[model samples]
Target: MPLWLPVGMVAGVAGWFWLPGEQAWEGLLLSMAALALAGFAFGRGGRAGRSVAIFALSVAIGCGLIWWKAERAGAPVLARDGIANLTARIERVEPLPARQAVRVTLLPLSCSDEGRSAGVCDAALAPQHSRLRRSAVGVIRINIPDENAVPGLAPGAVIALRARLVPPPSAAVPGAYDYSAVAWFSGIPATGKALDPVKLITPAPTGGPAEWLADARIGLTAHIMTELPPGQAGVAAALVTGDMGGVTQDDNDAFRRSGLAHLLSVSGLHLTAAVGATMFLALRLLALWPRLALRAPLLLIAAGCGAVMGIAYTLLTGAEVPTVRSLIAALVVLAGVALGREAMTLRLVAAGALVCVLFWPESVAGPSFQLSFAAILSIVALHELQWTRRTFEKREEPWLRRLLRELAALLLTGLVVEAALAPIAIFHFHRAGLYGAAANIVAIPLTTFVIMPAEALALIADCVGLGAPFWWVTGRALALLLWIAHSVGSLPGAVTFVPTMSRAAFALIAVGGLWLALWRTRARLLGLLPIAAGAAMTLATHPADIFITGDGRHLAVRGLDGRVALLRERTGDYMRDTLSEISGREGDDAIALDDLPGAVCGPDSCTATLIRDNRVWHLLATRSAYRIDRAAMEPACAAADIVASDRRLPDWCRPRWLKADPNLLAKTGGLAIRLVDPGVTSVAELQAAHPWAMVATDHDDRPLPQNDPNFARRAWAARDPWRDDRPADAGGMQR
Candidate 1:
């Protein structure tokens, strides 16, 4: 309950996230020593000294814990890279939302380099080679192209597959999502694609708790599908189970835009409702038995029952990060009831957060953890204020007056939570739900009073063989909820895209928010200084001049007119969406290169010119545009200040001019370039300024050359050099 607990854990998470990967072990040892010294000082020092020592101890402990977790979750180093024949057991199978592929987590039982002497290959894998001899080689994610081909695949199923094994990827751009760090913390060593059909050799063990739960979830989802329309069923299933695969992309987008997306996830709201409803029903039933009720402490009994139900539901929903967070909170509340202590205070929330950080340190980096804790802490702080108490003091009036008070309370709570979470939402998702308060006003009451209650009843009925009617009714409520979401989402400017802010700015804002939420004194007003600073930083930041995908296939640049111009008409959805979000652009209407104000698109290439600081710079997308003759290639290379192509160019290409090809792209990953007075700066250079710079390099230092002889031969063999539609060249620009 001490503020130090959460603060320390946060410091530790920050250390882990930002510290150099190679020095993690060293940092761990140093932190432990510092923690010991601080603890000693805290126990022996005077009052003021004790406070300082406790703060130091907390930070040290945080750093130690983070390093400890990082060490435990280190990625596996395969005995051999490239194609490998692996025998493994499926630990989990999830269908990516709105995607055709199925992502499966596999525990490798054995792996051997392809074409090697099968019996002589190394059976020992990096993650499982420790003294404990655990067989898990860390979980590896494999994307199976055809979901139907692995329709019967479930957890515990053993299969053999040939896959191109590779280490997890790093952040594609600086400040972008770090896939490698996420995977590493989750104990995922590598990711790959199944080269052929997964040959299932064994089925899942029957009657196990995990297997039973999986089967139950699948069956419930299937039943929902049968009883309700596709969209309604998907929403219903999402509420009941954590499976979001059934929800259509459009519906998902609508919910997100309308600020109703939280309802779809199994988070605090759902857990709280389920537990509260269960306890309420249990208490009513207990009261019917007068003699039993007289002897037993009803509150404690109800708390016990609620705790059990919360745990059961969390497990049923696969105990994802948010659910686990909710479960921890429920248990804390139950414990408080058993001990006759007031719950739902800041201390209880801090306790829940401390537990989550200890067990799931990686979650600290996720948006859900930040937003959930912020909202809860803000609500508690708001409730503790004198003004809020005064508003509720005169509550013993008429029913209509009570109803009005409750409505006002709900509105206030929603507003506070939205306000608390807005910065985090913008920082993580780059969008603010403009109508979130209005949407919550209509949607929260309906969901809490009708939809969730109906869902709980439907779940109970389904267990007792009277579920179809309840499910049908539940679907109707869900349909209406969706209607509300759609209506809100359809409003003009329902979602406002914001540019990504620097880590320093986000950290400043977070610290300011926490200071405001944690303190009750008038001094809490001081928190506004850092908040204002962060806001100013955000306003002063500028969008990148050029954005390139990791694959070196897509490119976009900010034209002189301050509008984004795409190099190609067709681009991946992820890239397009990311660009739109970061550039504060609506929809996908960013002008194509040919349509830009000062750009020219030829058969084989597109060229644009931007003048800044009395300098005229030319940008050319020459690759894969059309077949270009030698003479044309030389002129294009000589003329342009930046050339982005995917093909090999002659050595005569200007060395001072930036040339982006697949090789440099492979090394640098994705790029976000800004045009400075003299030249350009890149995300990679900015990243190198941070201590965590090597985390990405640690994944793969020597990527295969972009123009590997054997690879190029195979790659070009299928294409015609003279094809008119083909771009002249395409590759990453040199750093």
Candidate 2:
């Protein structure tokens, strides 16, 4: 019934995949046709029927659009297993400061056979020359260990390298981030590490507008880094070029904890600052000449200039989702100005959201999109309410009073935004910045009033070779800002870890928040029901007792005393820290085998036991713990109630014993096991119960079997041929 129906449609289409199964295009089409027919039939009725018709039509259109987009962005043809000589043109490059690596996304130009000698980049032997010729335009991500690899690498540069290209990995554990899905939508077919050094065959030439813009950004970032201190330079570069590679991990963590992480991203705030500053300067200069100001519609002209500046900034920053959303909103306002109409904030926001969803549908699932839109909607709703109330009480206020009112409004806006985004932040990131409101109160004004304007001036000055002084001043300001972040972040209780919430609970909370924000009546109080229910559901959920990595190399189980016992000595710090936080473990100190109760360690294996509900659950980390001999492994497996290892166990290991070896791990992705009296239930098993589990497969979307009969036999024989002494009829047991 409203123009925002398209936005709802977009949401429906995006969320369709959340239902647990592969959606059939035929069924979707039939349902849509039925809905359209029903809508048409209902349109003959009164206003109420028309409203129902509109809702049905919206759902139909949304489902159709989602299905169409999925069909268009189909899975790419992946490389075969093993190393291949790849000749590709670099499409994008990002530096990983933490990994000391350069991640390059490339478009494959050619591929050599797996066994071909590494350094071959002949155009004649390209994809066209071989059967590996691929017609689909897909991107491949390659991570080169050398940091220097990306120094001169720009988009459009042709290069060659040998690498073992694998499909993007699925979640390491259930409920974790699904990077494979991200890759699917992003059109990245494969990801791998460079086995040989990346050889640049041809340097990128300044050919097109996009290339020129990228080169300019790269050059400007380098100049800024050269002109400022490392930390200050990093912030400046991010503000200017959206290149955050130089930002150190320590500073990143500090900013995030201090609730200033939004400042690092080039979003609505940055765009508004640049465009508003440009418009202000343009109008000021135009007013100096009465003839020109009078002849031209000054506001319109200024708005046009602002629009142009916003577009330029968007292009310069790669037109990311947040930037695009902001740009669309600004354009809507500018359009209203051009048409001599007052821009309604709600309508403009809705229009911008519709445009973003139409173009970048996947963005609906992203935190940036959700958080950005939610905060803006909340602020707009609050502002509208305040304006309405103020309209009734008309009293002229002094300048000092007006200034104080504005400051209070600013503080209120920050508080509203933080409150609105809290649930989303917790759901996605599992952490809430405790002092986000306080941090925003201090940081927003400094960024909006001081830093951004200075940065804009510096950019203009840089063009005329007079940027050094301005950059120096900007750097000093940034340093002070960083100091604030550090100080605030170091304060006690800066951030609190929130447990993960179920998708259903999060959806309920989101729906409730939207209802409260959008409706302007006492009926809005009804939103409290769903919100309260979501909170209750989250509190009722329990943490996993045992978790295992996708590779089955590491396992962490909660002991009876509520302490987490890490089975392996060497586990990734990231995984360990994440699990520790989930288990409510304090500090980052590595928990040793000796420190864990009921943990018995042998030369190369360890067994940990957990007693729960009058039942004992034994976990065995076999040769994978340290590659113990079969003699050592047999005792650990034979005695254990549940076993996890990289290698498969002997046939004598029967069905009664729960086995989590490499084969099972490969199929499950990662596992979170809950020990019960009768048996154990895993995250994988619960996920598999849903029909969508069959559709959501490995990186290539190939359905992996839960149990492979030959898996263990092949795995055991592969390790040591002479050690395959099991009976011929012995078969593998499913978990």
Candidate 3:
């Protein structure tokens, strides 16, 4: 019963996001009213009915909470790709490897053709006469490729720059990550890369508490980097300040592969270590004065100190979803200690989750929340087992035996957490670390006890100008941790990749996990049934044989050698990585289409033969810079089963299966085709056989209905709000 409230809340929030498009407000309100009435009617029933009534009401509240949040967060999204000169104030700045990541809020500005002819805005721009007609407002995440390009830039500084900006795009493929939706909720409308030099018009002011905290974090990170070597400095900064921009890509990859990447992020582990140390110091100091200790509530006083430390640490670390969740849970435990009550329970977790949902409802759909909660729930459940409790009970025993018992318990916890989080990691990132348990056995203790403590001491001692010794210790500990990550990551089978699975399957697994972790009796064992079923469904998932980008300019096909071949050797990193992830393959070593055994290519066209389900299928695509003569390419196009091209094709050039040319792809952002033995014989059959494969899109990639009543209110859902005419180059939706 204690679990039902959070469960209902999660279900309602998740349901809102999982639905295909926006729901009618009228319909939602009607449903909520009906549920509320049902709850009132059931109030007279027994306790069981009352429990159901409470759950129903909670679900209704959850829906309303998320819906309201979505409505309030709506802002204007950039309609298309263009060169926009804008004046903006920097809201936040993060240092990355050789780059400075800045999130800026755009001010009122105008775009003009004269700005382009001055040799400033040229790459991927539309007609020279066209300009940004929409009022571009909201936060835009821009990356200055050179870290030192904009000197002395920090949060609250106003600067002017002409940057190449584009709207937040939709999923590259069906069921892929949707950045536009995330931007919609997070208030980031566009992302850009700098083209010209940035001009700083104003310096950062001595602002509010939030800006001061940001400035302090930046200064601390700079000091840490200056004192330590590059390899260790980035990790040290991240452990202390949660700014991971300086960590090299190779090091990040090593950590992820080794399953030790969590060390680099601030989460429950960091909070617990910080709180534990604070409480320990407080208790020891109190003990030093026996008279005061006897007269005071030492435990309560220490709890207060721990709570304050935890809260401070959370704020310093960016207050990300995982950190905030952990803070809430830690605060609950501290409150319980002050009240002399048991605090570590599923009920406690439920309370934290409920509060998080009420505040940051969008986090429910993200991997951070899911993985964090999953890992903790699994550990708590493992400890709740009777067998586990009896095996680790306190008793008179040899020191060596107790040491072995503790080691076993640590290993067991690692395995349980790994098993619980593997599916989620793969679902979000396409790969999960295989040896993370072994990696964590060493890396976790090193980070929590050795590295983080030394780093904290170094930061504190630096205030008095005596931090060199502590800084050296922290650097050396981090060096050892990095070495372990690289060594483990290089081992064979360190990570595993899986094809993306359905949301339904993930939900089933999640429900089963909760059932097993929340229940205290024999009923928990039955959770294994759904878990196994979900795993089976996951295994049954199959990657598509062919993939096409939203613009139809990029294509990836599974070749005869079981490796994926790209239509062109040169393409954007985003497109290549997206194709690789969805197909369960690595993108770095993509083979050229012409080099494949059963593929042939010309300057203007290419054809590849694929054998699937005992049938040979031919794919034809255009690579021409100009529209070729339709008559000359008719035979080849007619022979292939699937045809793709960015240019519009003649009506007579229809393929037997799918036509992913400009006209169709404009409506469907991207296409991922899974060939079957008895596939649809004609393109007309696609609507019935493979509608789910289509990535719906408008100008902004929000797959909303054209006639949806609320479309006007949602910028991303509306057709380009600035310009009415389409571009001549078949750029899907142009403003």
My TM-score estimates for the predictions, one after another, are: 0.86, 0.85, 0.86
**Could you give candidate 1's per-residue lDDT for residues 189-288 as a string of tens digits?**
6788888877888888888988888777777766666677888877877887888877888799899999899888989888888898889988999989
Error of 1 at 500 (Å): 1.9
State each model's CA lDDT, in order: 0.71, 0.69, 0.73
Off by over 4 Å in 2: 1-7, 23-44, 77-81, 95-99, 115-137, 146-152, 386-400, 463-465, 559-564, 581-594, 623-632, 655-657, 676-735
Per-residue lDDT of candidate 2, residues 565-650 (tens digit):
77666666767766665554532644755468777665456666566555555667654444445554554456565677777556
Q: Which residue ranges in model 1 land beyond 4 Å of their true spot?
A: 19-46, 77-86, 95-101, 111-136, 145-147, 161-167, 193-196, 463-465, 559-563, 623-627, 648-650, 655-657, 676-735
Model 3, position 159, has a per-residue lDDT of: 81
Q: Of the candidates shown, which would achieve the greatest lDDT relative to the real structure?
A: 3
Tens-digit lDDT track of model 3 for 205-233: 88688888888888888888899998788
Per-model clash counts, in order, read 25, 2, 0
TM accuracy, model 2? 0.85
